[model samples]
Target: MTTGRLLIVMNAGAGHSQAEASRAAIRAVLDAHGRAYQFFLADSGSALPQQAALAVQQALAEGGAVIAAGGDGTLNTVAQAVLPHSLPFGVLPLGTFNYFARAHGMPEDIKAATEALLSARIQPVQVGLLNERIFLVNASLGLYPTLLEDREAYKAQYGRSRLVALWAGLVTLWRARGRLRIVLEHDGQRSKLRTSMLFVGNNALQLAQLGLPSAQQVEQGALAALALRRTGLFTVLLLLLRGAIGQLHTADKVLHFTFQRISVRPRLPYGRRRIKVATDGEVGWMSSPLVFAVAPQPLLLLCPATMETPA
Candidate 1:
């Protein structure tokens, strides 16, 4: 009952001029292949649910695959809808930071990427769950989320420039002051601490000790957590400098740890005043008492066969 067709879900407003060019090239490849695929556009990827349900149902009926043609957020939406049904998922990498695509060795060239998708191998990828919602990458809180929200506005005015984002983040961090209570339980020990930022990854990225030029693989059975404590302004500046140079290996105030499961409860009460949470650039505010757990092998992804090689 599987169709040979493909479903391409696009967020038309994801990236800049180059992203548009990539889209055109992808269209050409699909046309040349004579592939039966539909292009569904949504203004904001939040509207994906309406188009995704039907596209998924049709693709399932026809034995087709669903391809996410934008950024990580768009891909996350497609994954949310199709993962439970066991449909294969592919990425087109037409967004600002295509982490998933880069991690999987997907080509940045639109035509080449499409061609690779035609024959790419698939493997199960781990997903993380907070409450009932699933996150493909990592989820973060505290200063980082505020920075993301501010950067969105900044990008609106300055386009997708990393410099603008950096400036906005620095400004936000300067004015931000709050402590987040986190309780982490793993390896038979529980610790409670206050931090400026906390991040939990479905898979860990191995960088050259500089925290850059890193690679994140879908770990089949584990979860990773990072906790950043409050630091003096001078230390924060040093960390920023190292991060910019991609040499951020050690920051005395930053606590990086990995665990299979962790729980976080804000000392503050749950309300609109709650802290914001972010996952792969998507931002939202959440109330206190957030539970995070590993959803092992929750979804299947189409990736290059060579990715299975040991890193």
Candidate 2:
């Protein structure tokens, strides 16, 4: 049970049309649990990271836990605040894809998640950093980030759905051109490669799909990196075929590896020393050369008492 007041920072746009209903359900569950908590509904138009940071500061001052009530992106914003202070954090998975919540063994249903939070146990979970920005899932450069950019626009115009996302990916792949030249340094080794895509995995499920053995234990304080080794049209087609058949890791043109930290630099740098990067489905620009590392201190995530950390 929450020993002190719990601060909840909710994103107004997270649940879309059902945002209100979700909020009511959360309130009812918390009240039934007799938890002392305060609510802060983040303005949809305001900068979420800033708003969440302020809310986190308030929660720390009140000597309580902070709960992020929304999808992975919303959780990421709240995490930015909690991480600096090394505060305990909770999550309410009210999103289309509850990747981070599911990774932590959080139930999808709101009432169930609430109950889990009430009798929660704190676990230190690893988080990945891109130029020091925390990301709970994966980060990517090249074709994948390009696909994310397309998917966001498509979702805006046609609404979000699995079918819509697939359509967006196809459209993006058809239009993508050329290869990326990057210098990647892992451990004490460094190499220059030309490829169409690169992905750094922090989520176990995604890593498993890429056939990495480390997917079984994501919190082992490491990262799985995947890169397409060839950029030719035929190589791209072969990678797509292998991916469709669940043989991506076995494909000759794909490189899959694990690391505790890595750095990436683009051959053609952007002005102002910045480069485009995507993490946990959110895209932004960060200063180059992008350095990714596993945080030294794991995040204190509140999970169900019965939940076991994934192995």
**Which of the numbered candidates is closest to the native, going by highest lDDT?**
2
Clashing pairs in 1: 2-62, 2-63, 3-62, 3-63
CA-lDDT, candidates in order: 0.70, 0.80
Off by over 4 Å in 1: 1-3, 15-20, 203-220, 245-247, 270-274, 309-311
For candidate 2, the per-residue lDDT at 243 reads: 71
Off by over 4 Å in 2: 232-246, 269-272
TM-score of each: 0.87, 0.92
lDDT of 2 by residue, 227-269 (tens): 8886676677777777766678777788878788889987774
TM-score for candidate 2, please give it: 0.92
Kindly report which residue pairs in candidate 2 clash with one another: none
Candidate 1, residues 2-71: lDDT per residue as tens digits?
2368788887656646656776888798788776777767666678776677778878788888888877
User: In model 2, which range of ten residues has the least summed lDDT?
Assistant: 267-276
lDDT of 2 at 260: 80
In candidate 2, residue 173 scores what lDDT?
Answer: 78
lDDT of 1 at 196: 79
